[model samples]
Target chain A: MLHIVNKSPAERNALESCLRVAQGGAILLIEDGVYAATRGNAAENHLRDALSRFKVYALAPDLEARGMGDRVMEGVATVDYGGFVDLVAEHKNCQSWL
Target chain B: MSEGTIKKFMFVNRKAPYGTIYALESLEVVLITAAFDQDVSLVFLDDGVFQLKKGQQTKGIENKNFSPTYRALDGYDIEKLYVEAESLAARGLTEDDLLVDVTVMSRAELGKLMDEMDVVLSF
Candidate 1:
């Protein structure tokens, strides 16, 4: 499954809720959720912790748009929209955490 | 998992507009994905109905009004908009209070429609 979180952890509990129920799948951050990919934000530790159990990915366009492109934590992979479509295809289902 | 397959895509909107960016950004995704030519539909439920509320005065906020774009959705071949009856009633809103024409249905009916979808994206 692909767990898509579109909220910034600073603004909502969507990311936390998603992490709890993710059960070893790919977590794709898009929209404002790309803020979580920043190296030293409040959500960084949680995202780092998630890397051990699940594949973490962020939308490249969103990250660049937010000016956090270079601040992404080490292990989170960045993908374009075409890559996003590919991830959706690879996963059996998707759960969007708003 | 295959390319060239058309899927039923339903975008579930549950938040109010302006207060946050979800509503507008979700609309962005809906417009982008519609180019894929899938079976697309949209549902306005909970505070999301407020997004379509008539007489929005966004001029005070200095944000460019995006509500007008909702009117152009049909041009993208994405028009199956739905409003939850219970949500509308809870908010004391009638279909006449909205900016667009939509089929108002019970939550149960919406659930059935949801079950028929191949993909569900909520914002």
Candidate 2:
């Protein structure tokens, strides 16, 4: 399964809610949701914990747009738009945590 | 626009850049306001503070890196940039991480400053 989250954890609970229910799948963080994958953010610990259960990915463009491309935490992979499409196609099932 | 017509304009940015259009839209509007010689001040809080962080490279995302425009604000006479102390701390960022020179104030102090604005716009 692939879980997509686009909202900021500081501003919304979409990421938190997704983490609670999602099990053993890949999580792609895009848009404001990319904030969760950065270093020093309050949600860093939660994302770190989720890493054990899922392969977390963040949109490269979104992180760069926020000027945080270099600050992404360790263990999380970054993907471009093409990679995003691939993730959607690779997964038999996907969920967007809008 | 006469000298007496200049108004205090405050643009409150709460969204992270590029997550949505809010941050960019607010910046554009702020530039437009500066052209009118309005007394413009930008307040960055919450994720909005991320807009001011340095080293924003957007080539990979293929979006115009608008973060550089923030540095150009001073040339436009838009120099009053305020950041919330709590917001930076929450994100583990300090003033050193910001691209522009701004006054960092507590939320309470910011609120009082906001009260003095003739107009306040939230993004």
Could you list the iRMS of every candidate? Answer: 6.7, 17.4
Please give the TM-score for the first chain of candidate 2: 0.98
Question: TM-score, chain B only, every model?
Answer: 0.96, 0.95
Model 2 CAPRI rating: incorrect
Q: Put down candidate 1 lDDT per residue, B1-123, tens digits, no spaces.
A: 657999889898978999999999999999988998888999887788999998898889998778988889989988899988987998999999999889998776775676566788998
lDDT of 2 by residue, A1-98 (tens): 67788999998967875675445679999999999999999999999998998899999999999999999999999999999999989875565655
Docking class of 1: incorrect
Show model 1 residue runs off by greater than 4 Å: A1-97, B1-3
Tens digits of per-residue lDDT, candidate 1, A35-58, equal: 998898998998999898789999
On TM-score, the leading prediction is 1
> Among the candidates, what TM-score does chain A have in each?
0.97, 0.98
Per candidate, native contacts kept equal: 0.29, 0.00
Regions more than 4 Å wrong, model 2? A1-98, B1-4
